[model samples]
Target chain A: MKNSPTKNQISSYIIQSQEEEIKRIALELHEGVGQTLYSLYSGLQFIEQTINSSNMKSYVNEMSQLLEKTIQEIRLLSVELHPPTLTTLGLVPAMKSYLRMFTSTYGILVDLDIEGQEPNLTETQKITLFRVCQEALGNVAKYADTHFIQLDFLFVDNNLTMTINDNGKGFTVENEMQRSSGLAAMKERMNLIGGQCLITSEIGKGTTIDVLLPL
Target chain B: MVMDNLYNQTYMKQACEQLQGTIECDFVGLAFQESKGPNIGWKYASGNSNDKYERITLRYGKGIAGRVLSTGRPMEIKYFPQNILGKALEYPIMLAEKLLYAYAVPILINGIPKGVLLVGFRSETSISDDEKKFVEKAAADIKKFLSLEKM
Candidate 1:
């Protein structure tokens, strides 16, 4: 008789499929729509230069500006969906770029500190770490209502520990865990990879999340 | 170029107020792509409970305003959070305003959709066809106002 998968196994399968779908959509947005918009922008610029009538030229200029905005929007969306750097440059660089964009978008200052060299990690490990940070940062942006954050990456011995701290209005961790799926997802992601995700927060104090993965 | 001189926040606020009153809705908002910025944001609102909408910036195809701008069509949600395609949180305006129903129409400029005019109700009430048409007409009027300033 064939054995049925356990609950944890089913959830892991779902998470993996979700990541794959996100990657596919990101690729379509970047390579398909992004390229098409770029060509349209170039085509409009060519027409703007070739057109003789001032009225027509101004109209083309407006169209070009709209297309430029659309292209930028698509680029940002695609990157946020699935950063290309995460696959090519590894975790540290990918997190750095994502934090930069996050700061620009939300006006939150992230003080990122690293200790020791980045340990070699499996592809799943790298993505899992990146996603945990992404989810934590997103929650901070949405609910923390703070301007400053601290991110620490410590690679010591055979373990990689990442700490995210926010100086914001915090909530009761237990209540939030029950109320928010984002928090649950972060914990589930860490558990799936044999890692630990610790979240501690008080009502008036700030929040801190520590993720530790054994290498 | 000409937009810099004619972009009036007061006019937008007043338009939003008038639309809110006309539709008998709890909230009315106008979201547009700033000429100098790549993102879309709610610039004007009427009957807003809080100013949180100002902090929300949406990329194209993300939220209601973004969806309308991209599709160049009107969108309606009579029962929000229920029977919706995406998460209720994705529609920040609705969530922030506690909106139960919403209708958004695109404001076109030079034959291209450039902005969104949204009317929302806090109560779960279905908008009549006449009300939808009124909102669309208001969007068209706003489009004309925007285009007229460019010339």
Candidate 2:
């Protein structure tokens, strides 16, 4: 499945497929790998308790440590595969939870202003939009050197709108076109929704992003 | 592993530089999360000229940025000042930034928006389909790198 594309198409196809595959593998890691590993650990613990060979005990202890590390990695993998929050609480709430973590982890204040009752969006819509926002914020956290950030949402008149603004160094859109894929993906999501995306910035003023989606 | 505040500092600054080249606009950045936790909405700039945008925190559905964040989508305004109602006092960031034509993209993690990415052209620059593609690609790529999916 990974090697069927033409040369020019291979990279993009591989990346897309890889991401999808990773999601699948991550899920398997959670549901199957995780359970198997835990069961093994439990079995080993029982063995360690019942049979008291000193050498065997030491070997089992070492294996237990290794298993513990694997378990942690698997958990991480599972989260990556499909964020539990995304499934449990829908897109908006999931982002709220993520923002809490992002704010604390990065020490960046991300003020959220979401208005209008949310209409149920398809899972794909939610994921696509979520992915785009994740990328944009990552750039802000990595590049936008400002102390205040605003995230606003509006669901009015059957149109879904979003905006992100920051007081940081601004750039030229033409120049940005030459570098980076983050912006590209954002636009794709908007287009998929038959929506529009716009970006504005200045040398020392700030940056603002606005998006509108047909509900 | 815990990523220190230094990481945020570095990235925010880097984002400004990157935007300058990528967007061909100017200023960049916004507020950073404080050590104590989330704070009220505010606008903070680290690149270009910082003026009106720094004054107030936008409520959801207000202003260009607010609209995008609130809806969790993207917006394109070929003639920003002309298209929007009132002036900078009403649209402070747009007025201060002197953005005549602007476009914004919402950054969402999980299902909600975490931030926004904006690019503007001075005077009367109409957003092209190609340019829109660029913004979307950049937005998604950045999210993937940030591991927002994990969040």
Candidate 3:
């Protein structure tokens, strides 16, 4: 308590504290709420197996639908807290899963192109790249009014490059950065791993975000 | 609630207006997620004339909308033909839409990307750093709400 100052230092400490708190809540959602939901889902499945009636099955199906939705919500909450895929599987798999989910949810076509061989990246690098792409995709969903978006990954030698391009109502890049923090956050996250992020776009055209990292 | 409907419309409207206001450009639209993807690219003409941009189906990586739909990221550019790569010019959303300067961002959730949010300026005004930050923040906020709705 004594170490926490009210001005710059305390503010940073408070922010850190806040992030930790969010993480804790996320963890709780995973451990407590997620488990409870999973239990409920399993119990419903058991009941679904025991009962046999075509008409009753239809009603059960409705209940199952609601349960499925609840399960999906719980899964999303857990993922939002801390993605297990990122921890167990690596960034590539996590990204692929995320892309598939994106296409299904938004009814958008996602063309994912992976070029060259992908080497094993450090956990830090993988997480950094994942977060950068995550944020980049976030921008696209919230902003780009386009039907198609492409995420391209190229690994040439020791350098890795990721390009996210979209064709929507394009705005001035300068003004976007001034008004929006998503781009800056993406750049900052990439910069942490000694990478660079670039954005290019046009009006009535589209926008593209390029991120480069050294392997 | 009236506020809820108003809020939704306002949100959609503001998304278009922000693009119009920031870039000092005309023509704003929103292509939401449809069963068959963003169908019939509706030119959200809150500020511009409702002339000819209503009947369009955007493909992935072909036009401006298609590219954003495919990539799930933000974009910005000044000169269209001069700056656009020649080989990737088959898409008509850019030229057909008549966008000059442009910026777009993806609305994402839980480390996943959904749809895209876009803004455009018909002129060659340089997009500053601050503008990008604001757009990104707005996109994130919107995505959060969308995710909540999903839940």
Candidate with the larger DockQ of 1 and 3:
1
Candidate 1 lDDT: 0.82
Off by over 4 Å in 2: A1-22, A34-81, B1-151
Off by over 4 Å in 1: A1-21, A31-33, A53-70, A96-120, A136-182, A200-208, B1-7, B21-26, B47-52, B96-98, B121-134
Q: Where is model 3 chain A poorest over a 10-residue stretch in terms of lDDT?
A: A6-15
Best by DockQ: 1
lDDT of 3: 0.64
lDDT of 2 by residue, B50-70 (tens): 443444444345466656765
lDDT of 3 at A20: 59
Best model per TM-score: 1
The digit string of per-residue lDDT tens for model 3 on B28-143 reads: 56655443412325434445442334444444444455566556667766676566644223333344355666667766544433455666655666567887777677678777
**Compared with the true structure, what per-residue lDDT tens digits does model 2 show for residues A80-194?**
3455567567777867866764553344678999899878887666766676677777667556666578999899999888888888787777688568677766776667556
DockQ of all candidates, in order? 0.16, 0.02, 0.03
**Stretches of candidate 3 above 4 Å error?**
A1-32, A48-61, B1-151
lDDT of model 1, residue B101 = 90
